[model samples]
Target chain A: MIVLVDYKAGNLTSVQLALAEVGHESVISSDPSVISAADRLVFPGVGAAGSAMEEVNRLGLAPVLKDFVATGKPFLGICVGCQIILDWSLEDGRTACLGLIPGGTEIFTPGPGSKVPHMGWNHVGFYRPHPLFEGIPDRSHFYYVHSYYPTPSDHADVLAESDYAGVRFAAILGRKNLAAVQFHVEKSGAHGLRLLKNFCAWDGGC
Target chain B: MLTKRVIVCLDVRNGKVTKGVKFAGNVDLGDPVEMGAQYYRDGVDELVFYDIMASAEKRPIDIAMVRAVARKVFIPFSVGGGIRNLEDMREVLLAGAEKVSVNSLAVQNPDIISQGARAFGKQCIVLGMDAKRSDAPGLPSGYEVYVQGGRKAMGIDAVDWARRAVSLGAGEICVNSIDADGTKSGYELKLTRLIADAVEVPVIASGGAGTPAHLVDVFREGRADAGLVASMVHYGTYSLPSIKSALATAGIPVRSVP
Candidate 1:
């Protein structure tokens, strides 16, 4: 069973509903054992990083998630879930993160005619062939609604990039067993569902 | 590149899809969930469901209805109407809506905007404004904010309201023209442009979309980031694909339907 980590950040229902659409059975759990034992873990959150991390530590999920990531199982992080996996976030006054991936999240600066939060459907360009994007076309539109984007300490870990207002940032990051997206795959329509399906079938080998 | 969003608005009342002219002359369209699913399949970028009677009736939004629609729509969908506080916003977001839009309640309590944004991310909070044409000297843009389904005017400038809403952490703004609603003449381009230019957040233009040209005009002239439609899509006048195709031809960036 796929375990959906729920620390009560936000929008866990949408992710659960999206998984159901792909015919996957996911258990939303805060239990460490359930999460660590699951074949795959999907950490999805929406909200401030500081509070999300607080909940993670309060529930002792930070260690649980770290242990799960070390198991070499298929894992996915989305939005704030994706950001919290990084080293730190500039949101909520520079909160420290899980450090699962070598990266830091920074807020998007408003450029000429470019809105903050970058809320809209933007194209995702693939950097390397990965199973998570097996069917999703390069430059396919995905819904994004976050001001912060993760910048990997090592550029090679970047799996995909999206350009908004001439600022190109990491949209998808994958390293071995861990995969994370800065956008909401649950709300990205067909392409997102297809990506979720691919993740369901991913063996965490590549 | 980010594509311009085309949203399908379903003005639902008592759990049924309803449409009215300028917020009156009510008519039931069909099942909201089924219609939303069909629109999702037709390649609409987003969906908005506003509970028409929630605010006026002093009732909270219908969670079951929002759940029903969110179940079928895989794309992003927003729920509006009667969201008075962060708890109400939480209920709707937990019901599976990607965003919560505040209209009359937002005007009554602007703090809900910042609270909702802080509780949930700014992206999850949407500011929904209803505006009517006005020529007051204080309102140079000639628009005033309306509330309670356009039955009451708040005497606030539409442009100023939008800017303040964004400052309060609203990620996007949906502006509906009270005078242009249901007329199908076209969107209030002047008013929409004024509000769009006033805020950096993405602005969605609502009301008065008779044909594809209206959408083209809104995006090209009004500079709206998105367009919201009800009658055209509700009555099967134009499918989402047809409108998107027209937009693509008009040089507006839109997602290609498979």
Candidate 2:
């Protein structure tokens, strides 16, 4: 079973609905036992990093998620879920993160013409080959809607890059059993669904 | 590179897809869920289900209808109309909507915008403004804000309100023109441009979209991030693919149909 961690910081129904549309059966849970036993896990969240981290710590999910990643099972994170996996985030004024990934998140600098939040469909160009993007085309468009993005302490952690406001941020990042996307794959139409389907079939291999 | 979006607005009343001219003279088209699914299949970028009668009638938005549409549609969809407070917003978001729009309520209590933004993140809160052209004194932009589904004018300048809403944490803004709505003439480019230029957040130009050319104009001239269509797509005047293909041919970037 695939467990979607519900920290109650925001809604998980959209993610569940997307999974159903892609012919997958998943349960939303904060229960550590259910989450630990799952064959695969997906952490999806939308909202500020500080509040999301609060709920994750409140539900005692931070350790459970860390343990799940160590089990070498397939794990996927979306949007804000991808941000909190890092060591820190600039949102809500220098908040601490899960510290699983090397680096932290930074607020996108608003340029002369660029807009913050970056709310729209943008392209994600893959930097290397991986099962998570097997059938997905290079530079495929994905729905992105966040002001803060993950900047790994190590540059090698970035698997896919998308540019905005003169900075090429990681659109997708993978480290062993854990993989995350800065965009909303659940809301990215067919391209996103295909990504989810590929993650479903992956066996946690490089 | 980011692509421009084409959104289809279904002004639903009583669970049926209805279209009205300037928010009146309703005509039932079909089931909202069914039409939304078809549009999704046809490659629509986004969908908006606005309860036309919800705000005016002073009733909570149809949750069952929202659930029904959210079930059939996989892409990101927003629900609006009759969402009075944060409770209503939470209920709709929990029911499976990615975003909830606050229109009339935001005008009455501006604090709700900040509250919703703080509680659910700015990305989930959408500021929907219904505006009409006016020569009323002290209105700098010559456009007035309307509430109650375009029934009452707030007498406040639309441009000023848009800036204030963004300052309060609205992630995106959808501006619908009451004058050009259902006219099929095209969007109110001047009015749209004012708000789009006044705010830093992505602005969606709603109302008065009759053809693919209109969308191109909105993105190029009005600097709109997205275009919202109601009667055009609902009445079979244009198909999603046709419009997107037209946009691609015009050099406006759009997602390739899968």
Name the top DockQ candidate: 1
Give lDDT tens digits, candidate 2, residues A1-206.
Answer: 98999887646887888888888989988999999999999999888899999989988888999999999999999999999999999988899899878999988887655788888888999998999998889998898989998999887888999988888899998898799999999888889889999999999988
Q: How far in Å is the alpha carbon of A88 misplaced in model 1?
A: 1.6
Runs off by more than 4 Å, candidate 2: none
- Cα RMSD (Å) per model? 1.3, 1.2
Q: List pairs with backbone clashes in candidate 2.
A: A103-A153
Clashing pairs in 1: none
Q: Where's the lowest-lDDT run of ten residues in candidate 1 chain B? A: B133-142
TM-score of each: 0.97, 0.98
State the lDDT of candidate 2 residue by residue for B1-258, as single tens digits: 778889899888988889988888998999988999999899888899998788778899999988888777767789999998899999998888888898989999999999999888888889999999999998999999999889899999999999999999998999999999999899999998999889889899998999999999999998898999878888788999999999999999897766
- CA displacement after TM-score superposition, residue A199 of candidate 1 (Å): 0.7
Proportion of true inter-chain contacts also present in candidate 2: 0.76
DockQ measured for candidate 2: 0.78
Candidate 2 is graded, for docking, as medium
Q: Rate the local accuracy (lDDT) of all candidates.
A: 0.90, 0.90
